[model samples]
Target chain A: MTSPIAGGVDCDLHPAVPHLTSLLPYMNDYWRDQVTTRGMTDLISQSYPVNSPISSRPDWRPVKGKPGSDIADLQRQALDRFGTAYGICNPLYGVQMVFSEDMANAFCRALNDWLAKEWLDKDERLRGSIVIPVQSIEKAVAEIERCAADKRFVQVLMLVMGDMPLGKRHYWPIYAAAERFGLPIGIHAGSAYHNPPTSVGWGSYHIEDYVAQAQAFQTQLTSLIVEGVFARHPNLKMVMLESGFTWLPPFLWRLHKFWRGVRMETPWVDRAPLEIVRSNIRFSLQPVDAPPESDTLNRLFDHMQSDELILFSTDYPHWQFDGDEVLPKGLSPDLVRKIMIDNPHATYPRLTVKEMTP
Target chain B: MNVQLRERPQAASSTGIKSAIADCDIHPARATKDELHPYLAKRWHGHIETFGVHAYQGMMEGPPYPKAQPNASRRDAYPPEGGPQGSSLSFMQKQHLDPNNVALGVLNPLNTGQGIRNQDLAAAICAAINDWQIEKWTSKDARLKGSVVVANEDGVSAAAEIRKRAGDKNFVQVLLLSRNVEPLGQRRYWPIYEAAQEAGLPIGVHAFGFGGNPITASGWPSYYIEEMVGHSQCQQTALASLVLEGVFERFPKLKMVMVEAGFGWAPSLAWRLDKVFSKLHGEVPHLKRKPSEYIRDHIWWTTQPMEDPESRDHLFQVIEWIGWDKLLFATDYPHWDYDEPSRVLPAGVSDANRQAFYLDNAKQLYGIS
Candidate 1:
């Protein structure tokens, strides 16, 4: 399928960078240890095994070689397939491994440096998220500070699952730094070692397991709100990545109900939970289609209270979802343009506004 | 006005009904220690050890069974303030009645311990819950009604309680949650159904999790969504048990409502059951009607956390599969992931179906008049 650029911006395209291995040496030791311990070190190595594809699924496999494992190959595929002028590359190294605070910081710094050297420095269209090990507040903050001056670093990427409640005041230092640097906090779902909220023994099958992932995202989001993180860090912007938007409407209403009654516990929150979410929270809709007849996308738009809150994401190379036409088929052209291009541009203006035609 | 009248066919059908809406699932506050201690026969006090609370807090907390993510930030943990005062009673009045949006709310027991173990306590607790609901909720708030929750573990005691509470004007149904009991068609539970049918009250089968049961494929889920989504599966299991066991046929008037379970999965199950039964009629000759027909005639469902986006088309598909009247709208208020009435139904749903899903169907099922 030919990838069509919506409103001149192909929001789903991702650029890849080579030379990530060279920068890996500069990564924090804690992250290196995490990659080894979390089994991600093995998984990453296996992805590029000589004979086979990185991901076993045929749909996710690259045309000839493993495109996902090599940053340069990934960029070539993006330009060739989608005619993408620029792309936001969420690196595999930052997300696939679980790192301690120190290691997470080092890994993030190394990845950011590599991104700057290999993609951001060379390509006008390339933008990046500073990957940080969220476990250590100090390291996460330092990494954010290190990347703050870079024009291509659009946001700070943090994996959502961890041992402590995300809204806990201990993480305030990172939020303070992100806020200071004017960088949005991008939280992606999925972690190698951390037990997500849905780790509860809930279902017997694959559908049940996938549903559990959505639930974990909801729980984490609620923790961020009820724990007063949004209220305390009013300027902090958060993007809930990977989780679909179908569940947000009901969750928002319930959160508001709890917030009204539980105000005594978290007095710092001046407004209802829904209001806080609307003000600070953003969600990326990837793997977007679900039973097309359900009109899920439209309802999600309504439930989110604003179309602007949802940004388009393709989760490229993942199987189970449409390759390029991730958005619902029947939506009016206007709605498609908003979701595929305008909304993301509005949220991450810096990346969206960069020179693309050249 | 003519255009509005044309839009609501279901509401149009309810011109003579007493109320516009009736909620099928409402849980009443449990007895305070003071009210419950005396009702406890000496042997049951030992059972209280299983649940740490001394009768009163047990009632306030609802079930003693812990959810997958008990500490996860949940929206349902706090109830709206300034609406009602008593722990259980206040929620009904404050959340359901005061809003005037709900005309009649059916009440269930908060504590399921009586149903799980110690039949005597279960019977006593259910009885106490019904009477307390009547005294505090139904009597003062005309919108409140009651369900007779019997101890599923002991059918005899459960039947007796059903027989006792079925005749009360305020008690309109029987409450049997999805998680606690054996399949509804099991011979052990027939007595309770018989009693409920004789009393003219439908059975309310709500969803819960693997409290003591090791039935879940893999233990329990660690997250609340997993627990909540699993309710649909439990509902399917219970629904199948009841249908295949001929609970609907044995007690023809014994209607049941599957609460807090998603409705999208219902039609597929009905089709699957109907298709399987057609080929295997010899296996279960007791069924007088097709499985799908039985569900349309006897089963009803409540929608909370109503799977929006899907709710629009899915509700229509379910209504087409069963009939237009099988669904009832609920808020599942004071719990996390509560559905807001205004926001729940999608924009494109016709007004007639919307009214049916939102209110009228529940009234018709409960015989609100």
Candidate 2:
């Protein structure tokens, strides 16, 4: 199949790099001390080890007649398979690096720089999320300020599970920085280090725990909206990343219900939760393998107040995802265009379509 | 009261008596730690201590777990605190069990001694929790039914407890939290099942983080958020274990209800299990029925954190996969994510399906009529 370079932008992609070894120095001293004391040095180890088949080290050559493991090769595969024009590359470290505040910040800075130099520098179509050390607000804001000047940095990436609630006032600084930079903040599910607060206690394993991350994102998003973060920082755009979109409709309804009764508690929240979401929130619809029916998606759109809220994401390399071809089959062409292209263009305007023929 | 009885007869004559639904997964407010402590075993003092006020923190570490910013170790890790007190339960009752809302609520003990591996201590703990629940919740509310936890590690003891509690009008089911039990069909657990079957109490299998089961997720998530998401897989595994082991065949009258496990994945899991059974039929010929059929005949499910907007459609899809009668509505109260019964049902659900899911199905399952 020929790759179609439609002007559409794929909002979720990952540019793989040797895990966060490069950014170790920029972390806060306190976080560095914590990691050293806790003996959690190996936290950043990728699921694939150095000798593993998926590892894409520079020195490793593909066996004769075998496929290579380079970032460019993966990008080529995505381009060939998805007809992707430009993609907002969500790096792996940002999701996985959560041990000490220092380690997280350093890793994010390193990953952002590597992303900028390797992928963004090489192609105008390759935009990136600035991975901020969310544990360290000062470093996170500093990184956002430093990277926002780069046109390719379109969003600040955060993992949904963390030490503080996303709506907590401590996170205001990061939101303010994103607003200042005109960058949307992307919150993805599944981090190796922290578990999201579930209604139930943490389950025994990864699959069960990871599944809660999406719910946590919903809760966090609700926290952010209901706590008046969105109202306080009106310009900040938030994207729920990697989590599936089906559960959102009920969540919005529940939020509105709470808003009605508890408006007194959060009087600063100028509008209903759904309205805030409609105006500011964008969700990336990835792994659409379990995408709700068109009718369900349509109802959700109605409830949330806009179709522009759902953006397209591939969650590349994740198993059990709906490939690009399968994504557009269930939706009308216009909705498909909005999910796969226009919504992302509207959210991240700096992501320009590049002409690439394959 | 006489007028109401006369009115009931007249109402019944007019509407043809709709059966009352029994919610098998209701939770009443737990007794205060001070009230409950006197009844519990001394060793179990630590369990409540670590868990705090809720007794069962569900999957959450009650207190003294590493906080984001730690100052000092908490007083006791055994019973964590700062959870649902009396006020929280009052809020839950107001929201979930208002007469204008859901008419009935079944109270499940938060911390049951049955899941602990120590048989003697487990039994003592179970008894204390049941007593505390009865005194604090069931005694005050007729809308509530009780689920008694028995010592599962010792089936004889567990069965004895079930038998003893079976005759109690307030007790409706035997509550077993998911942990490292042998498959439900195994000979070891059969005594408890038999007692429950004889008593006409359905088995309630709720998920927990510790004991009985190994954590299957790849890594430990640092926060509670990761743990909650990972619950569905555990639910699936538990149900699959019970089904594949022929638990349904061994106890035809026994009903099993999965709680807090969302139904979104049920349709797919049931379909996949049936297909697998078709391919591996030779492996276990003792199971004559399809897995989905067993589920439909014997299994029930409660909806909470009811994935809204699509709540109706999601329930419909599962009903389409299993049968409509197998679905039940529940509000896992006192927990932070408790679904408000009044608002849980989306505006889109058809009346017929709503009646089945919200009322009729549970009525039949719990023999409310």
Candidate 3:
């Protein structure tokens, strides 16, 4: 187990689209005309600003185009480079930014279709997540049902910060639908900006905004656990993609401590908060925010205890790590194998190939 | 300006939990608004009686979370004399100060007038709360000390209030809430810091205030647990704003004490802050030092709702990163989650760390003897 797993499953890889026009061919005539007439050039990216240093690694950024625009480039960099056997492509094209429920629904449909046609259809190793317009639960559930037919669409994608807490009852339908289809609910790190990233009003810098995303992840975790999202949808898999994993240990410790003190208020949360998290929630391991020291990473892991909670991810095109050192400094060989291979297989029920009947 | 060193707690008897020490964060609320009438001006008596106080929360009268007992306090803390919990000094002495052997208990009066909408009324109430602390609690007991409560929104008046109490040895710090109209680092609240620095008082930012925003960034949390855990997030944001916005660089002498906001996240937050600051250094050129350096130098943290990691080693690791010297002992007296000094830490912690944590550091910070 000391050797790195070559055919590791990459749970999160972004397939970038340069502009809204790229999806126009996939959209119906009514929505296409509406978008073009409105001069909606490109949907504003809520998470990654185009020119921000965090958007894409310098070497990975295209010499003359979008970072992940080319299928050949993604294959070369993410799959071939990392020896990834199966890579789940998550296209963050700002389709979820559309305000109107109808427009948002149309964009989500177009994005899913575009992903199926362009990336998933082109590569056998590539899997995709259905980007849903989380603004309207009805439309979000409808899109989930529509995409459930495609086995390649293995997960439901939504932003971490949105119109409301994902755990709220209004959004539980999305979770229920995903559970029915065996699609893991993948919450990406981004915000709708309906509110400030911090509890205080808007921050002054991008650094503040970027650092505050960790807190958003923490809040949403509590929301999901306390709101009984896990209890109702027992089999649901909630994957927080591009959300750093190091913060989870301390966050869970504090959550579980408080739960012990105030469990009566949330009777549905019968188990300890940490237990609920280990059993239901999984976090992507890229953008590891732990200190570079091996000891610190080991200490964090000791607190976490469970091997299945972290899923391997390259977070392709994003500049989280400098080189091939996507894994933190000091994870044990067995834990690495679990994170890179077995964990992702367990998290995404559709990722594994079934044995042929003799 | 001679600094006085308090007598060391008769050398850690057995478990190394000091019996006699300064309790940095002890909330002493008024039993009723009528108790504060003597401290308030005649002009605002009618205003208080008529309009009452309006806090920047979802509800008009109570806090957002109803699970917190009526006063948002411990039921056991309610005085036998029929007043609210923590309102009676005699009961506090018997229940907390006497049994706990608190040498100096700092009064952090909340819910009196800290988050009110009316600036004049808010300032008046804050002043009255401070006076009420001295009259009913601190002045009566020689071991009790008051924290000058200020209406943070009105910096001018808040500063004036600080100046008035500057010479009083009984008041050791200026009390402000983490949830304020703006981040404490912003210029809008600088006057309070300036006065605090001038008065040689540290600013103790306690959890729970009405900063005109929900406890969470998205909205109000559904349960008491979310609200409780969210306290650290608010404190993190405040501390980040204070350090990154160059508040510490401007007022070099100003010290901050993060009360009831656990320190487990401090080391992690500092690491993240330094990581972000190195890249965005130009945005805040005035910050002469690293974010962690300012935090280590200017800020002190109180251990009340102390973080409980799965292994005792994890707790020690957090303490190591935060530096034992930076910690000040506190028991959010009368609060349901109050940490007893003897039992707070895991068994393996050394006597030296325990002594510094419980007594020495806080005594030095407050110049208490």
- Per-residue alpha-carbon lDDT of model 2 for B115-190, expressed as tens digits? 5555677787778777766776677777677787888768898998889888787777788866444434446777
Worst 10 residues of 2 chain A by lDDT: A52-61
- Candidate 3 stretches with Cα past 4 Å from truth are A1-4, A353-358, B1-18
lDDT of 2 at B326: 71
Q: Pairing residues by index, what is the TM-score of model 3?
A: 0.94
- Structural similarity to truth (TM-score) of each candidate: 0.61, 0.66, 0.94
Clashes in model 3: which pairs?
none
Pairwise lDDT winner, candidates 2 and 3: 3
Question: Candidate 3's residue-wise lDDT over B35-76, tens digit each?
Answer: 888998998889867877788775766667775455656766
Docking quality of model 3: it rates as: medium
lDDT leaderboard ranking = 3, 2, 1
Cα displacement (Å) at residue A129, model 3: 1.3
The sequence of per-residue lDDT tens digits that candidate 3 reaches over residues A160-268 is 7776767788889999999998999998887767666677666666767777777778888898999999999989999999887777777777888888877878899
Which scores higher on TM-score, 1 or 3? 3
Q: Encode model 1's per-residue lDDT on B1-369: one tens digit a residue.
A: 011233322222223432355555554443345455554566556656555433311333543334332322133333455221234555545444555357777765545444344455657666666666667668887777777666776778888888777667887778877765344566877888888888888888777632343223223333233344445555665676678778788888888888876665565456445544543455577888988788878888787656443244544543555565777877665454556555666667777877787678877777776
**Which 10-residue window in model 3 chain A sums to the lowest lDDT?**
A349-358
DockQ of each: 0.02, 0.06, 0.56
